[model samples]
Target: MSLSYVGTQLTIYVGSAILIAGVLGNGINIFIFSSVRTYRNTPSTFYFLVGSIHNLLYLAINLTFRIVSVGSGFDLTRTSLAWCRARSFFLSTISVISFTCSCLATIDQFLATSQSAHLRRYSKIELAYRIVLVTMVVWYLQGIPWILYQNISPISTTCVRTNAIYAIYVSVYLLLVLCVIPVVVMIGFGFLTYRNIRLTIALAELRADRQLAKMTLIQVVLVIISIIPYGINNAYGLITTGMTKDANRILIESFISTIVSLITYLYYMGSFYMFLISSSRFRHAYHTLCDNTTSNSSSLLCLVDDDYFCLCDINQIAQCFLYDKTLDQCKHCLAQGQCIKGDTDTPSDYVCRCPRCHFGSICQHNTKLFSFTMESLLSPDLLSSSFIKKSVSLSMYIIVPALLLIFGTISNIFSFVTFRRPKTRLNGAGHYFFTSTIFSQLSLFCLLSKIIHIIINLRGLFVQPMVNTILCKILSFLLSSSTRICYWLIVFVNIERLYVTIYPTKRWLKEPKTAKKIIIFVIMLTYGVHIHELIQYTIVPDPKYTVHGKWCVTQFSHSLQIYNQINTMIHYLSPCLVNLICTITLLIRPARIRANLDKKKSR
Candidate 1:
């Protein structure tokens, strides 16, 4: 047989096995995470639960479609534009939502282990729900663009991007959003969370936190590994598109693409196994679920409250021996190996007891077989020192922000007052500085509100209404707009200074009226550019603290990439480039002047 045929056959068999195993595992994960009270209540578990559900859907839809298409040359998605769009939309939505939940889970852990009590308190079950809801809405909307862009070819039964540019844009976007951003955030937050857990004071909480962190970290590492090949393939395609194609290049690209597809399948299949291997709690829950299914317990109550007799008590020797002597009572006991003839107090009465690690009257429940000990892994002094370090970290959280807020507020106020004076305002460059100081003051005010919020949250007295939508939107706008305006204002001031240095004869450039006009233009231009923020940013309710009120956040996903690119250009890159050019020009002008003077002297 040809190598291609062999490889194809292997892929079909392996993919089928993965589909079955992943569906079964993820289905069980969903059941346990959703049903178990202890797991259900946890914020990280909520994220994991949502992720598992999406993963199962992804595996069912994507894997089954791939397997069928490969084996029988059947492609449902290629039958119509609507089907293609729907398939593309759902594929992107599920993948993004799954990864987003994982990212949120990582962030939730970081917040839960934060040195700040206020931040830690934010890690609640209700918050997880809100985040998941927001994520779903955002990703579903994000998939709309894909639906619009994807089409089925009329000549060939295939789905493809509408054009090469769109394809390139998507490849780069996916690389950043799916791979780069998630990997960076997970690793960065994972490091911080690990450090925080190491310094946790309570032994029980420490162990639990450590296990969860380790589980999340391992899953994140695996996800990064699986996606790296896909990212490289996307990047390679983006760079090599429209280039001269050769057979060797085509062969190499084909190999990479195949490998990428296989690894991506593994990504969808591996999460359940990762949890099983890395998490003892997950294993215990799985075992408990299995035991419950096999046991004759009609209700979970019978498993916990074993004292009460239920309909499932048919195997109970004591009940059988107590009520009826006509039946061979010891015969039932002998079958269980828990009792023999004359072993009990009497023939009619019997003693029934389960072996170790078994519970319930009939020994139907199986408890966890292994106990984990961390004392051997962690030193006693380290545990004691963690308590002291935590107290110090908490104090720093309060003190550092407070000092910065107080000093920054005072400095900005003084700068604003000094620059607003008529003597300073008349100077062209001073006007720009004055406007910049005003923005600086506004920015400081926003910072002050944040610090105050933190303090109030620390005291457990903060109300949610204080962070309502209007406040959140206004604060976000002010922070972003003010920061951008400050950057541009500084750039304008530097350019104005360079203008006067290079062209002293241009008197109009030094006029306060000219400076005033430029300032007005800068304000209008920045406000126009950032107007979308006013619409996109709004107050979202904290699911856990609805009574207290909501916090501000941006909604929608379609325009965010474009919006961010514009902001980066206007706020950061453009200003830096302008300032650099002006500085170089100004420096070179003085050198040119001295060089001309030397030439004149020699003449």
Candidate 2:
């Protein structure tokens, strides 16, 4: 048999073993961490619980996919676009979540063992849940682009990226997310944790503290070791693509690829073993759990030694198991000013469960130094009353727009009259200013119409008047075209000023005719670009709102999102960039001119 065939067979056998062992191990880890009260309450264990779940999923999905594809020669992921996208999305998202949870556990351990009380208090179960929730949301959103751009190849019957650029982007993104960022965070925090342990050896000697630090260090080291080879392989593949076509080089790359694949799987498998070997507490918990199962006991009692498990009477066991044993004494609650004694039936339940911000088993933390409710400051009903609502509406939609319309119309008219005087009419600069005032007046008219529409809608007086197809199209087209023209006319005026400032001897650029031609071109260009508004926008019936009423709506294609992005870049961002450049040049020109004159005088 060929060496490649032998290697493939060996991988199949070894991979199957690893898959079974990893699934069993992670399943046990989850059961023990969740069942034991000691492990369940601690913050780092929450991260470990979540990480174990993610690792189990990663191993099962990834290993099973590989096994099936290799053994039966059937690749389900290559069957359709949905499968391809789903396969990539799940694989990437789950792997990243697993790594994130591991990193969080390390950080939590460091904080929990810190000498600073503020940092130590941050190690709460609620905070761990919040962090995990945010991580899942962020990673899931990050996978959306992958789903949008992945496709199935018809020739090779495999899933691949749709664009070469996107392929390169995914490679770089994975390199950073999977390797670079994680390595840096783990190494930096790992070093700090080690130093803290060394300096505070007496504090670190506690069993719980030592266990947390040891487990976290082992996890960090395992993560760093497992990911390095995969990262290197990714970098090599990205660098070597299309570079050479030698058969020997191809074989070498394939060998490295297989080794990296195995190494990646090793990461998923090694966590359970790491926990088992690094912590005696975890081992003892596992053994007790196994012993209980073998003895066929259905009791809730998790019998660790007398010190670990909170042993109490049968009735007290339920309360102690549910909450901390410290609550039974009620000293912490009595110290706070909120204790309530219980009746004869359950006299031990003297701790009052205050429904406010206080910590500890008996609510002794007293987070509220100055007790006050949010409603006392600002009531929701008061804010939502008719007077406040109308005041805001009148100021925004009525008063502001009305004042702007009045001032803008009067100013534009005065400017027109001033520019038409004999002394200004023949000036090239006056022509540009004159054209700009005209477009600005038109733009103001469009704005006034829109504000009136908003006011009418707010009053609920016009249900379907503007919903007519022709009216909708005409209003949209007029508003967009006028606004664009107004902005571009300002740009033209700036350019004219810049030209005059730079080359005072250029007579053609100083002509009024040139200004007029540029104004005509600006108007035409703005109209042509926004002509789509006339066709794309129309009236659609709104059955949910009113039976006979319609709404003005614009129908969009899949490419509309891309078009919107390009439109924003060109119309909004391009003008700002150009205006900034021109302003800077204008500011610097005087200084440069003065410097040149000074040099000439000295010569």
Best by TM-score: 1
lDDT values, one for every candidate: 0.65, 0.66
Poorly placed runs, candidate 2 (over 4 Å): 1-3, 203-208, 282-603
Q: What tens-digit string does per-residue lDDT give for candidate 1 at 1-603?
A: 644555467566777667766775687678778877878877888898999999999987787677656654446677667878888889988988888888888888888666565786687889888888988998898888888789988877689898777777678778888777877888888888887877865422222355666778877887788887778777778788789999866766675576578787776778767876677553221212322443655333222111222222323211111223323235322113243244355653454354433332222223321111111111122223477864565565457756776887788788888987889877688899888877877776775554444334333454555455455566656766787899988988887888787678886877999988999999998888777777766433322222443333344352453344435434665576567646756665676577679989999
In candidate 2, how many Å is residue 452 off? 94
Candidate 1: clashing pairs of residues: 464-548, 464-549, 469-539
Look at candidate 1 and tell me the lDDT of residue 136.
96
Candidate 2 residues 309-410, lDDT tens each? 433222213111233334333432412324555553664556555434333333322323122112112222222448877567546655676677789999
lDDT value for candidate 2? 0.66
The candidate that wins on lDDT is: 2
